[model samples]
Every structure is written in C-alpha cells, then in structure tokens.
Target: MSIWRSYPRSLKVLLLAMLVNSTGMAFLWPLHTIYITQGMGKTLSEAGFVMMLHSAAEIIGSFLGGYLYDRIRGKRTLLLAVLSSACFIFIISIGLSWPVYILMMILLGLGIGTIFPPIYALAGSIWKEGGRKSFNLIYLVLNFGVAIGTALGGIVAQFSFQYVFWVNGFTYLLFIFIVWRALDEPDPVYEAAQKKALDPRPKKEFRPLQSFYSLLILCLGFMFCWVTYIQWQTSISTYIHLLGFPLSSYSALWTINGLLILLGQPLLQWFMDRVKSPVKWQLLSGVIFFILTFALLSQNQSYGGFVTGMVIMTIGEILIFPAVPAIADRLAPLDRRGMYQGLVSGAANVGRTIGPLLGGLLFDGFGPLVLLYSCIFICGFALICFGTYQRLQYIQKEVSTVKVNK
Candidate 1:
C-alpha cells in the first residue's frame, strides 16, 4: 500500500492497468495452441501457424504503436489500443468457432501488441531516475496478474472454457475504463523530446546511425532469446497435453512460472544492484539458463522435471526481460526513444512468431528432441550477438568521449 503510493501517480495507475491486462491475457495464452489443436480439430502444425499469425500482427502493432507514441504523445494512443483489444475480445466471446476465432486472435494480437511499447515508453517517461525499477515493478505486477489468473483459470476450465472467455472480456473492459480515466496525463519527458526535435543543430552532432546499429544487434539477439523462451507456451504446452495431462495441470505450470517470478524479481534485483554492469551479467547468465532449460526439455519425462526447468527459466527471465527495454533506453537518442523501444518489442514479437512455427515443424518432422536442440543452438548464437553488441557500445562511448574532450 505505502509502496504503491511511493511511485509516481501515473506509474501507479499504469501498474493497475497492467495487472488487469495481464490477467485477461493469461487466461488465453496457455490455451491458444491447445484450443486450436484439440478443441478446434486442427493439427498441431495448423495451431502453430495460427499462433504465428498472432505474433506477426503483433510485430506490426508494436512498430506502429511506437510511431504513434512519438506522434500523438498522450494517452489517446493507449486508449485506441485497449479499445481495439476489447472489441476483438468481445467478438471472440460471441463465438469460439474455427476461422472466426483465428481472425479474432490475429486482430486481438494487433490490438494487444499496440499496447506494450506505449506502456513501456510511459513507464520510462514517468520514472526517469529509477527507470529500471519502474519497468521491473510493472513486470512484477504483470506476473501477479498471471499467477492469480492462471491459478483461477485452471480451476475454472474444469467446467467450461466459455466462462474463461466471458471473464477475460470483463477484465479487458475494466482495463479500458482505467486507461481512459486515469492515464490521460501527458508525459513531460516525451513532450520535451518532441519540442527539442524542432531544432536539429544539437541532435545532428550525435551519430544516429551508430545508435541504430547498436540497437539492431541488441534486438536481433533478444529476438532469438524470445524464440527460445516461447517454446514453453507453444511446443512445451502442447507436449504436456499430449502426455495425457488435463488443461488444469498444463495451466498449473504457468501458475508456477508466474509465482516463481514473483519470488525471484526482488531477490534478483538486490543482486543486480550490487553488480557493476548488470546488463552484461543479465545476458551472460540468461543464455546459460536458456541452454540448461532446453537441455532439460530434451530429456524431461515428468511434471517435476518441467517444474525445475521452469524455475531456472524464470530466473533467466528476471535477468533478461525487464532489462531489455531499459538497455534500449540507454542506447537510444532522445528523438528516437520511442522507435528503439518499439523495435525491441517488435523483435520480440517476431521471435514469438517464428518460434512456434519452427518448433511445430521440428516436432512434427523430427521430434521434441530436435526442437529442444535447435533452441539451444539459437541461444548460443544469441549470446555471441549480445556480447558483440556490448563491445560495440563500449567503442561508441569511447569515440563520443574523445569527441567531447576535443
């Protein structure tokens, strides 16, 4: 309670909205592919393709949302996104049939995708000094929503999946209302940056292309990270179901995953604060966790093994996800902040789009072992890319310092 009020007023409001949005979203994500495969009478490959489409829409939405963040510079952009999400979700509640549901999923993806970057940008806007803390808090509460929603969703699903639809829709309605009323405040930093853009003299000296290159490498690595990460939702979830576990059991793993994140964030934050270069440690430690988790999956036969892998993966997630946007914030020039954040987000979605499609094909053509091995390989590649990006950043900084001294 005291901690809630300690944040900027806008940050507090946004966290609540994040909570609602995540809760609603959690109800669907764990079920998406399974619903298409088992309930809709679609094949696993078809389900993967549908999930890919959802992520593809998200990639478009993310970049567009970033552009709007720079252009519109207020809560209206957010309102538009939430409104679109709610509308699509409402249509989904009316009918859970085949092609209609797929269309709704893709539209909902666009709407949902549109919401993230602006929210992230707004977090950076409201909490300037403690920017990392703001992103972590938002992420922490987002998982609270996931933990609560998945726990309840697992139980509710025992009776009717339709009820899940209605409840998720209701949460979105609540999110829309909250964003409309409480989140209308202008972001001071964003406004200042927009005004500064009018005079090109100062910004012209800064190497925008160098900044872009750094972001491109960082996002490319991060995208592979997501590609490997999301197999839990797509391939792994379907794999669990095929083993004859009920949806409740499959969903419980998510409940556990969310709960573990809740426990992990604070402890990890304490440790991160002690490190000199937290971002470097984040990527280094994250790829190790990635390697280990995928290896576990290749041999995993029990729920308990999945549980252990999920906990390790959650630790890696805490190290990585909240920091990615913050790193982009550090890399971006004032004028390009929104676009950099958007591109990072877009890269993540692109990874999500490709992950399940590739995983499904691998699982169908070869086996789960093949998919797991491929993810491990990609994680190795991500590590090399991230390390190179960091070295490049160091060079960029040295060049800038020498220029300033002259």
Candidate 2:
C-alpha cells in the first residue's frame, strides 16, 4: 500500500520486526488466564495474581527499555530484549509446568516490555514529521499481528498449548534475526540531536520540569485507562470460560478486535484527518466508548453480546492507544525522548499490574456485575485524568508565554 511505502526504509524494517514480535506474544497472551485456570488447574484468583506479577515485571522492563534506548540506542536495546524473551519462552515450551511458568512469565514480560519503547522511539526518530501517523503505523502492525497470531493460536491451542509456546518462541527468534540484520545503531535522529546538543553556542532553555509534570499527569490517565481495559484479558476471559463458551470463542474476541482495527483503518484515518484537536478528541471519545462497552457487557450475557462489546471496545482502543504515545512524543525533549516514552509505557504497565489483582478480588467477592460496574467507574476516573492532563499542559504553556513577555 502507498501508505506503507511512505515511511522511511528503516522504519519499515522496524515495523516488520514489531509485527513479528507482536504475533509471537499474541499466541500466548490471549490464552494466559485460560492456560492457568484450565491447563494448570489453578483458580481464577491465582491466575489473576500471576498476571499481576507479569505486568509488574513489565513496568520495570518498560522503564529500563526506554532508559537504555537513550543511552545505547534502538538496535542494541532491541537485540538484548528479544534474546531474553526467546530464551524464557523456549524454556516455557519445554518445561511447561507450574512455578516455573510463573517465573518465566515474569521474565518474559520484562523482555517484551523492553522491546516496545525502542520500537516506538525508533519509529518517531525515523519519521519525525509523520506525527500521529508514525505511532499509528506501529499500532496497526501490532493489531495485524494479533489478528494472525490469535487466529492460529486458537487452533494451535486446541492441539496442545506446548505447540503454542513453541510457536511463540520461534517467532521471537525470527524477530531477533530481523532486528540484528536490519536496524542500525546510533540512528540519524539521535546523531543529529547529539550534534545539536554538543554545539559550542548557547542553546534555548527547555521546560524540563513542567514538561515532566505534564507527562506524569498523562501517565496517570494512561494507567487508569489500561487498568479498566486489561480486565478483558484477565477477568472477562475467565468469565467467558465460566459461561461455558470455548477458548476459541474467547480468542475470537481478540481476533475480531485486531481485524476491526486493521480493516477500519482507512475510515479511522479519514475521520482523524477531518477532526479538530484530533488527539484530544480521540482520547475523550475513546474513554466514552470504553464506558459504553462495559455498560453493554454488564447487561448482556450471550455470546453475541460479548462479540458486540469487543467491537465497541476495539473502536475505543483504536482511538486511544496510539494517541497517548504520540502525546508523549510531542512532550519529550530531544535527549529525553526514550525516558518520556518509557514513563508512558510504565504507566500502562502499572494499570496492567493492578487490573488483574483488583478484578480477581472483585470477581471472587461480589461477582461479575460488581466487576463490570467497577470498570465503568474506573473509565470515568480515566476521563478525569485525561481532562486534567490537557489542562496542565495548557496552563504550563500560558505560564511560559507570560514569563517570556516579562
């Protein structure tokens, strides 16, 4: 497609690598709760706890990944990340046991989390002018990988989860190959920034503290949105199983999610092109849709109802996820880009860390209705956070202008 070719060649290569990585990860993620609950004979609560640990690990990985990007650059950081992920995942394929599975999942999370910030940072670096288009392409390829992986993952799972693990591991190996061969170190963007920073003349001062404060506000909102969103992967998947629907049915929801995102991109891009304050509007509208999704889920108990919810949720997802990173990219200083992006990723991981444990507690204590309602309330909080993030940035800009005038 013309859209694909419009990106820089290196970015295209990075995108391909991302696609491979996401596909591998997808093979296991959609089925994680199910594997723990049914395959390992564990309770939902236990599965939730394990997922919590996994996400907590990701928080560390996300931060580390971003930090390393600024220091070491993308190519080396990527190779380090994927190599660890592959080793852990391969061990999982062979051992396929209980306590070991937990350890491996946490380690895998670290590796996987490390992989993303660089991919995103590289995309931004490779095509700075692409704006939302840059991050959106990464998101698109991500879901496209999800679509392929989840579909085949479901089939592979029916045969043996071991095969799923092996397939996932193999993909990571493939990802390593792509990254080692394709991506270059000390990229043009980084080199250019380094040259500018190293210049002898005085430089215009940047608002590091204010920008950082804004990023914190943004991350809070991002974390909350993820907190609610992640329930679908944890609690809701378990609930679907409890309702006696097959694993494939649950997997189909993600499949639909990815497919809708892929197929609906043209329409989404068209609307984005026409919209005012597109990032702001996209996030606000997305939170509203998330609320609608949970509301619908609370009332509807049928398979068709779940299908409908996934469609609604995917729309919100398409709008929100890419915009958050784009906002971070906008807010970051030249040298601190990776650190800022890492914080954003870490925020999302924090939500993922909390969601499963909280959802599990709610599901275990009060039941599914309470869990669904709670998610809707969390979405409401996320809306507040998003609004506050915008407000802070606006105020900071106004303050800066006044000082400049004085």
Candidate 3:
C-alpha cells in the first residue's frame, strides 16, 4: 500500500498537533531537572523525589485518560488535558516555589496524562483502514517529535529556563487550537463496533486476567530498559562533567541522542516489518544495549566512548520502542485498546520514576561505573523474562492449532 494512503485529513491534523506539542515539550525536557537542582538550589535527592511524584501523577493520569477515552468523547478529554497543562505551565513559570512546583508537577502530570489514550484511540480508530501501516506511521511521527524536542530543548536550555516554559506554554496553546480546528470525533458506529468486538461474552471470551499477567511480565523488562534511558538523560551529564568535560557537553549529548533517534526510527521500522518475528528483534536490541552500556562504563573519561555508547543505545531503542505498542496491539482485546495502551504507558512511567532516583543514589555513592553495572544487570534480567514469554507464546500457538484441527 502507498504510504500516503494513511494521510487522511484528520490523521494529518492530529500528527501536526503532536509535532507542535512535542516541540513545546522539547523545550522543557533538558531543563526541568537542571532548573530544579541548579537554578533553584534543590538537592539531587529533592529533584529526584519531585520527578518521582510527577511520575506517580502521570500513572494516575494515564489510566484515567484511558478510561475516559472509552466512555467519553476523545476530543473533549484531549482539550481538558491541554487546558490543564497550560494552567500548570503558567504556575511553573510564575511561582517557582517548592510547594507550588510540587503542585504543578501533579497537575501537569494529569494534563499530560490526558493526551496519550485519546491520541492512540484517535489513531487506531481513524486509520482502521491502514492497519499495521497506520500504527507504524504514528510511532514514526511520535518519535520524530521526541527527537526534535530533546534536540531543541538542549539548545534552548542554554539560553534561559524561562524561555523553555514560555515556548512550552505557547506550543500547548497552539496545539489546542490546531486540534480543535482539524480533528473530528470517531463515528458512533465505529465506537459501537469496537465495544462489541471487546465484549467478553463472545465465543472466545476476552481474557483480561491472562492478558494482564502477560503484560506484567513484559513490563518487568520495560521497567529496566526505561530506567536505563532515564538515567542517561539525568545523571550522564554530571558523570561527564566529573570526568573533566565542559558543562556544555551535556546539551550536546541530548542533541546527539535525539538526532540519532530522529534518523533511526523509520529505518528500523522498515527493517522490522520485513523480519519474520518481532520478538527476535526485541531480544537482539536488548542484548546490544546491554553490551554498549557495559562498554561505556569501561571508558568513562573518553569522549569517543560516550558517543559510541550513545549510538549503540539509540539503535537498540529504535528496535525496542515501537515494538512495544505493536505487542500491545496483539495482546489487547479489540475493544479495550485504550486500556492496553494505558497499561503499557504506566509500566514505562513506573520505570521512569525509579530510574532517576536509583541512578542518582548510585552515582553519588559508588560512582558512574556502579550505575552502569546496575543497568546491565537489570537489562539482563529483562532479556531472561522476554525469553520465558516467547516460550510460553510458542506453546500457546501450538495448542491453538491442535484445537482448531480438532
């Protein structure tokens, strides 16, 4: 099928909004922790705690967003999230007090939470005709936003913290207007059909418990991977600084990771589609990431080593990240897509919450090498879990075939 076939007007509008929203978020990405710790004079532990709180709020918000999307209009829920986010941004820019910052984190988490489920639902519902291609396109564009946001956020942070908030607020405002103008709610027939498909009373009842257990196993691996990624963003700069690099290199690192992701995601997607089993690619990526991270610890002071590590990690990320939603699509009940997406997102959030705090503690105590070793161990455990999951899936498939023949 032609790639452009998925580019209907509504999908186009949603993608554009995502681009703008992401660009705005990029302004905040590199600065949020820096501003709290350095600019506002909080301790590393304090900053980590705040981030943990933010993640907790995000977990709540994501699940709530998913539930709302299933029951209410998608557009209304999105608008609420955007507006609420704008309010938090205003508070962050103005108050800058500790209590206010904590409150804003919770509110902002809720605001951001509103976006994921509705956006995924919109993509799945609208691009029903495009199938896997549609899902791939959405993943590609979302990562594109992430790459741009992280890259630009580093550049912008070099200027001023306030500039980041200003850009973030304005982008959100623009996102609200764009979404309002361009998108339409899903058709009622489409909604009803989705609900029917997910109904548990069908010949083959939807197995929520089984799916939940499967996701729990998958999430254990995801938690480890995400913790490693978050640590790279949060503590790697400090580690490099201690190794005698200039402070400015921090931004450069973020820029490098973002640029690689921007360039790599589409190519990886194309390659994975041609490969027979996504599980193989997922396992391969995890192994690559583990090795590169180990190598990075051995050459702590070498700029070349850092850059090589970043490249290797980015390749692994390209393979692993998009495969997550694809796996969710396969595992989820047809009608409960939003819930499945929420669970996946929530698992990542849990990882994000723990990663920074744990990394910070390790970096401060035993140093960077210890942190790297911890990451390698966690990832190794994740790979073992993935192996178990693969074996179980194989058995399940064989059993299904036998039943079908009977």
Candidate 4:
C-alpha cells in the first residue's frame, strides 16, 4: 500500500507539520553538543550537564503535554508548544547567561516534549485501520525529516553555527503557521473513542496511576536500552575528534546514521510486523545492539571501524525504536494513551539524561573502551528485561484464555 493512502487529508497535513518540525529539530540535535562545547567554549562535562538538564525538563514537558492532551484537544495544546519552542529558540540563539540558558533549556524541553504526544495521538487516532504500518510511516517521515535536517545542519555548520539555529527557528515558525492554517481537529471516530472512554463503561476501570507506573518501568527499561545510543549524539563526536577527524566529519557521520534510518526503518518495520512477536524482535535487537556496542570498543580510534559499528548500531535502532510505541499502545488503556506515550518519551529523556553524563565521565576517566563496555552491560540488562516482559505477556494471555474457556 502506498503510505499516503493510509492517511486521510488532515492526517497528511499533521504528518507534514511533524516533518517540518522535526527537520528543524534535526538541525540542532547533532550540533547541540558541538555548539555548547566548541562554539560556546564549555567543557565536555558542562555540555553533558546542560544536556541532562534539557532532557530532565523534557520529562516534565512530556508528562504535562500528555496530561493536557487528554483533557484538551490536541491542536490547541500543540499550537502553544510550537509557539513556546520558537520563543525559546530565539532566546537561546543569543547566548544568554548560565541561568538564562538553563531556563531556556527547560522551555525548549517542554516545548519539544509537548510536540510528541499530540503527534502520536494524531497517528493513533487517524490510522486505526493501518495499525503498525501507520506508525511506521510516521516513523519514516520523522526519520526523513531528521535526515534532511541533520544533512542541512552539517553543511551549514561547516560555514557558520548561527545559521543552524536560525534555520531551525525559522522552520519552527513555518511549522507553527502551517499547522495553524492547515491541520484541523481530529476526526469524529477518535473524538468518539475519547468520549466513550469517559462514558463509565465498567469493562476494566482505567487505573491511570497503575498504568502510569507500569509505563514508567517500561520506559526505564527503554532508557537502559538507549542510554548508550544517545551518546552517539554528544560524546561520540568528541571521541571522533580525538581520533583526528574534523568536527565536520562527526556531523557527516550523524547524517549517515540518519540516512541509514531513512533507508532501513521501513524494511525493518515490515519484517517486525510479520514476525508476530514484538517482544522477540525487541529482545533480539537488544542483544544485537549489545554485541555491536562491544564491537565498537574493539574498533576504537579507527574511522572505518567506528563507521562500521555505527552502521550496525543503526540496524539495531531500526528494529528497536519503532517497536516501542506499539508496545506502549498495547499495554495502556485507551483513555490513558497520551500519558503512556508521554512516559515512553520521558523514559527516553531519562536515557538521554544519563547517557551523556555517564559517557562523559567514562570518556574523561576511563576512556572510550570503558564507555563501550559499560554500554554492552546496559544493553545486556535491557535484553533480559524484555525477555521477562515477553514471558509475563504469555502468562497473561494464557490466563485470559483460561477464563474465557471457563
């Protein structure tokens, strides 16, 4: 099926809006560590700390955005976030004092965090028929945006740092205006689903707190899986630089990662859907990721070796990343979809929060090999967690079957 056929007009518009927004974000992401450390003259530790703060703020934003999305319509909430993000970008571009920079980071995190729940909500609502394919398309568009954004940012950063932020900010402005004019409220079906959940049906009372805790654990496991990967954005550049590559080369490597995702994710999704076992896909991917991370350590300081490892890592990403949202959707009650998705993003932020700080400490004290070894251990633990989750799911299914038979 043509991916476009799966979505209606309004959803198409929303997807495009997300594409534009993510493209803008992609411009800043790979360059964020570079900007703070090289452009702004902060230490590696300082930059990592700032990034942790940003991710921490995102955790709050994700929760708040998800909560508000459940109560309010998504469009209004999204508009507010887009506007706030634009304002934050402008402020951060001017190179404020430490406190102001920290404040701006919080706002940026909140604004960015707000974007995901609505986007995911829209995808979940609009493409109910398409199932995993719909989510995969959304993921595809997002990665495409990242590819374009990172490639553009890398090229621009080669000439001027300010241009990266300016372009990113401008794109956000464009996204805000486009979404304001183009996207409508969700379709009636989704609206009805929202209303139905509130109509007091007693199938299983939606326990928001219990579901939230479950999602939190899932997110933490996700964090453990991804903490190592996030370092590719922050410390890996410095590590590469130490190996005698120019800063621009690091950016190019990121662009390569994005490109691989653009090419690989859809195919991976296709394979994943056919497998009939999301948990198995996740566990296997985690194990592969662990092995690949260890291989990266062996290739330390070799440009070819690093690129090869990154390619393998990207393959693991293609398998693991898209599976997350689908898994969350299955675990969450319909009423709590927004909050569960928020937890997923928040857990990722937690991973982001820990990844860079730990990576920096490892690189500074123990060196690159230690960091890679540590990542192997983290991925190993995540693999075990996923295995257990799968087993529990099997047990639950068996119990449900027994009850139905009785």
Evaluated with TM-score, which candidate comes out highest? 2
lDDT of 3 by residue, 82-125 (tens): 98898789778874678888888888987787687677767767
lDDT of 2 by residue, 265-345 (tens): 658866787865558778888999999999999999999999999999989988889888888877777678789889989
lDDT of each residue in 46-144, candidate 1, tens digit only: 886787788889999999888887787537778888888878877876767788888898998888888888888877767666748988988899889
Residue pairs clashing in model 4 are none
Q: Which scores greater on lDDT, model 2 or model 3?
A: 2
Question: Each prediction's Cα RMSD?
Answer: 3.8, 3.5, 3.7, 3.9
Off by over 4 Å in 2: 31-48, 96-101, 157-161, 185-206, 238-251, 299-304
Per-residue lDDT of 186 in model 4: 63
Sorting all predicted structures by TM-score, with the top scorer first, yields 2, 1, 3, 4
Residue 156, model 1: lDDT of 69
Per-model CA lDDT versus the true structure: 0.81, 0.85, 0.73, 0.75
Window of ten residues with lowest summed lDDT in model 4: 202-211
- Candidate 1 ranges with C-alpha deviation above 4 Å: 33-46, 96-100, 154-162, 184-204, 237-252, 296-304, 397-406
TM-scores, each model vs. reference: 0.86, 0.88, 0.85, 0.84
> What clash pairs does model 3 have?
none
